[model samples]
Each structure stands twice: as C-alpha cells, then as structure tokens.
Target: MTDVSVERRGHIAVVTVHRPPANYFDFALIHDLADAFEGLDAGDCRAAVLAAEGKHFCAGADFGGGGAPGERVDSSRLLYREAVRLFRVGVPVVAAVHGAAVGGGLGLACAADFRVTVAGARFHANFAALGFHQGFGLSATLPRLVGAQRAAELLYTARKLTGEQAVALGLADRLADGADPLPAAMAFADEIAASAPLTVRSMKQTLRAGLADEVAAATERELSEQARLWATEDCAIGIAANLAREVPVFVGR
Candidate 1:
C-alpha cells in the first residue's frame, strides 16, 4: 500500500503523506513524494498543497527502526537522492503543517514554495541532537529561507520553533488563523493558481534558479557527514536518549 496520495481539486493538487502518529519517513515514502511532485510537473497541476494525515506532519526518519548499519547508510543515500528531485519540480507547493516537522521533515517543508502552518505546529531541525549532520538538502534550503546565521543556530541547537516563531524568523510563510493549516494552505495554493500560469512559472524559475543544483550538492556533503557520524558512540547514545525521551549527554567520541 502506498503511503502517499495525490488528489486533484481543479488546478490544485493536494499531495498528502499518510503515515499516522509520528509519520516517520523512509526511502519509499520520500521516493513516493518525489514521484508525486514529478508527476504533477507533467499534468495541469498549477499549484499543490502538501499535507499530511497524522498526529505529526513528519517526525523525520525512524531511528528506532531495524536496519543493519550498512543498509541504513544505503537507505539514507537513496532517500536523499529522491529528495533532490523534489527541488527540480516546477509546480508551486504550499505545505500545510498542522503539527511537528522535525529534522529532515523540516527540510521537506523548506523545499516547498511556501508553508501555511498553525501556531501549535513545531518546526525542528533536530539532527544535531540526534548526533548527526542535517540531511535532505537542509544545508541549502534552510539557509535560503532564514539566512546562514539563523540556519546555523537552528541546526546547531536543534531547537524547536513554534509556527508563529517560524513565521517570525521567515522560516514559515503564513500562520493560519484557524487551528488546522489545510484550508489556509489550499487558499494559498488557490492564490497561486489564480495567477497567469506562464508568468508564474517564469517568476518561479527566475527566483529559484540554480536551487535544485545547490540542494543536490549540499545533500552530497550532508550524506557523507551523516554517514561518518552514524558510527559514532554519540549517535547511538543520542538515538537511545531520544527514544527514551531523555536528554543525551554526548561524549563526542
């Protein structure tokens, strides 16, 4: 069964990620997302609202899941490869973030053109706390949204920002008036769909020029760094701490 679904509402494609509770992503899910976005590029989808059906929008990768060390590294590589394809798509996307978007999940939200979120939602770059480098092209996308210093602060601290705070920092585009972000996101997508298609595409192309290539390069470095860190004593400790809901004391081995 596919965890991703695409629904058409006129020119707006509502692409939803379906993984309940924490909504942790894997290679298959990211690959499915890229496929959905690329498929939209070929059709009449002028705009898309990226939504999720679960408690959390995405809680990043499931570190607690079973996988051999080498298999885990390979999966990360494949996931990042598919993630880069999301940046190459031309369709404008507005993410409806109703809950937590953590680690690479935050990177996924940043990949969109705009994010419509609620104040209750949390945006976290938790890779550092996980004892790994940030992946999923966040090194490129996060800096582009909130500047180098702010991105560094977020990545370094692994801080969680509420949606209002994210909007204040220019990380999120809009804070929804209602509790849920889907309606607001759809409205935002409608605004994009209302524009002249060719001109909109031209503007997007100009504004996001070279972004895909930049993300691709950044992900390459991020993957390499993460691979090295995954074998560290700190990584194991951090993951165990996270699963246990405790703060980790990294020895920096």
Candidate 2:
C-alpha cells in the first residue's frame, strides 16, 4: 500500500499524503510521492494540489521511528534521490498547508509552485535547532521563495511563522480564510488546469528552469554537512531536547 493517494478532480490531481497524526516522512514515503507524481504526468492531470491527511501537514521525519528499517546512510541517500524527483514533475503543484510544515515538511511545501495555507498554519525551518543541515533541497527552495535574508533568519532562528506571516514573507502564496486549505489549493490548481495544458507546462518549465539541478546540488551539499553533524554531541542533545519538549544546550560541538 502506498502512503500517498492521487485522485483526479477534472484536470487537477489531488495528491494526499495519508499518514496519521504527524505524517512524518522517510525513504518509502518519498518514493511513493515520486511515483504518484510520475503517474500524474500521464493522463489529463494538468495541475496538482498536494495535501496531507493528518492533524499536522507533516512533522518532518520520524526520528524516533528508527528511520525506514534499513541501513541509515543508504536510506537517507535514497530518500533524497526520490525527493529530487518531486521537482522534476511536469505539472505545477499547489500545496495545502493546514497545520504545521516544519523541517523537511517545510521543504516539501516549498517544492510546490504555490502554497495555500490557513490562518493558523505554521511554517518552520528547524534544521539548525535540530543541529543538522537543512535537507530536502530547502537550501535552494527556501531562499528561492522568500529571498536570502528571510531564509537565513528562518534557518538560523528556527522560529515558526503563522500563515499570515508566511504570506507576508513570501513563503506562502495564498492564505485561506477558512480552516481547511485543501479546497483553496485545489481551486487554485483548477484555475491553472483551466489553461492550455501544454502552455502551462511550458511556462512552468521556463519559470523553474534549472531548479531541479539547483535542488540536486543543494541536497548533496546538505547531506554531506548533515552526515558530519549527525556524529556530533550537539545533534544528539538537540534530538533529545526536541523529544523531551525542552531547550537544548549546545556547547559548540
């Protein structure tokens, strides 16, 4: 069974990440999403809305879940490789971020061409707080969406931004007035689907030219730094503190 489901709404595809509670990601989830997007490339799917079926959109990777039940290094590499495929999809995607999109989840949202979020929705780049380098190509995507200075602030401070703040910062494209954001996101995708499919696809390709390559390069660099940081005592402390819901004390290690 796949963790993702793709349903066609006219020319728009609604891709739901169907994990409960936090909807954390791993290698399998990434592969599932890649496959879903690849499948959407066929048929009449001209645009897509990426949404999650949980309380929080996604809470990042489940660090306490033991990580995909495989060799950690190999799994991480495979996860990133599949994640890069998300950027290569031909159809433009509008992400519906209803709850929290944090860490890698925020990167997933950033991968979309546009984001539709509810008022109280949260966006965070918590890599530094985790004592790890940002992954999922966030190094490229975050700055691309919100500019260098804002991206640097979000990463360095690891502060959470509400939907309105995210829109103000250019991190999110639209803020829905209601509680549910998926309908608004799907509406946006439907508007895109109303256009000429080929023209839309071509324009998207032009607008996002070289983005996948940039993300690929950024992910490689991120992984390299993360590998080194994963061995540090501070990283362990950060993880422990997060799990305990407390503040971490980093000794610059």
Candidate 3:
C-alpha cells in the first residue's frame, strides 16, 4: 500500500499518511504526496486537513527504501510550492497533526496555514542525528514560527519535542487534548469557506508573499547545504552505514 493517500470529503480535502507500523517512506511517499497535493481542489473546497492513518503521523525518512544518495528529489520543493498554490486557492488549510511529525513530516505540517495537534503529538528534526541534510523548505518555514536560533538549536541537536513543546514553539496553533483534530480542522476550514472568497484569497496572498520570499531563500539554502553534503564523506558514511546495518563513525570529513 502507498504510504500517503488523498481523499475529498464534502468541501474538505484530507491528506493522510497511511504507511503503517512506523508511518515512514522516502522518495516513494514524498513523490506520491506531491502528486496528491497537485490533484487537490481547495478552490472548490472549504479547507484541507493533513492527517495520518496510523499510530503515528510519520516517522520521517524511509532509509530502508533504497534510493541513491542524490537522485534528484524535487518532491520536497514541489510539495511546499503546491501548498503555497493551494493556500492561494482562496481556501484555508488546517493540519491535524497527531503523533510524530519528524523531519520532512514536520516540513509538511509547517506548510499548512494552521495546525491542530493532538495532546501527545511529538515533533523533531532527527536529521542531524542521522547525519543528513534537511528538505521541504524547512529552512524558511520553521524559523518563521520558532525564531532562527531556536530552529538552529532543534536542527543541530536533533532533539525530540513533545506536542506541548510544539505548541509552545508556535509550531502548533491549537491543542486537541486527545480528541481527533480532524473535526476541529474541518471546522476551521468551514469558517474559511463561509468567509468572503476574495478577502480570503487576498489575505492568503498577502501573507504568503512574505513566505514566498522565505521559500526562495530556503530553496537556495537547502540546495547549497544539500549540495555541500552530497560531496562530504559524512553523507556517504552515514548512508553506507545505514545500508550495511552498521554504526557510522564520521571523522568530521
């Protein structure tokens, strides 16, 4: 089964990460998600909810998926850009993030206009721990909420953050107290649907212009950083070790 799925419900578009057990995948799911994002019709819809179908939202990358180190993955960029386009469709987006929002999964959540998270939800980068580069325009989106220093701290430390910390960091706008956040997100979408379309579109445009600039900057940053990592021994060593099921020891090369 594909890890990610998209379905339309009434005027609500729901995107779910359905990969079970750990809820993880790499290029496969990321590409599917990008395609799903493209096919969504938020203009006719009231709003969209990004939720998951397992015990956790997403456990991050699928190291076991077996893709080359640099296989030209524009999925992350495409996903974020499509999100920008969707927000421009005169409809709001409210993400219902339950469980783990790690790495690129956090990137997906960050693209949403607002996020409603369950009480026990958790978030983290966890990339630094694995010695990899960041993706999904997080270079731009994350700091907008958590400040540059805080974002740097999170990335550098690869610390796991609880849903409470996520709310405190402004990453999550609302907490759902063990309740399913999908209903609340749909309600928010309904509020947006009932509002004047032009006004909504205009505000969305005005807001995203700032984010657009950030996205551009982030694209450059992500590219440069990833490109640099592509050549480093660290990336090769880490990836190789994972493939071999052995511990990678980096000499800071």
Q: Quick one: best lDDT, which candidate?
A: 1
lDDT of each residue in 198-218, candidate 2, tens digit only? 999999999999999999999
- For model 3, the local distance difference test gives 0.71
Answer with 2 or 3, whichever has the higher TM-score.
Answer: 2
- The residue-by-residue lDDT of candidate 3 on 97-216, one tens digit each, is 887888777877787888888778888886675576776678888888899999999998878887778888888887776657778777777777777766776788777777755665
Q: Residues 42-98, candidate 1, lDDT per residue (tens digit)?
A: 988899999999888888888887566678789888888888898988999999997
Give per-candidate clash totals: 0, 0, 0
Q: List where candidate 2 sits over 4 angstroms from the true fold.
A: 66-71
Candidate 3: the clashing residue pairs are none
Assess every candidate by TM-score.
0.98, 0.96, 0.79
Considering lDDT, where higher is better, how would the candidates rank from best to worst?
Answer: 1, 2, 3
Whole-model lDDT, model 1? 0.91
Name the regions of candidate 3 deviating beyond 4 angstroms. Answer: 1-6, 25-43, 72-90, 230-233, 236-250
Which candidate wins on TM-score?
Answer: 1
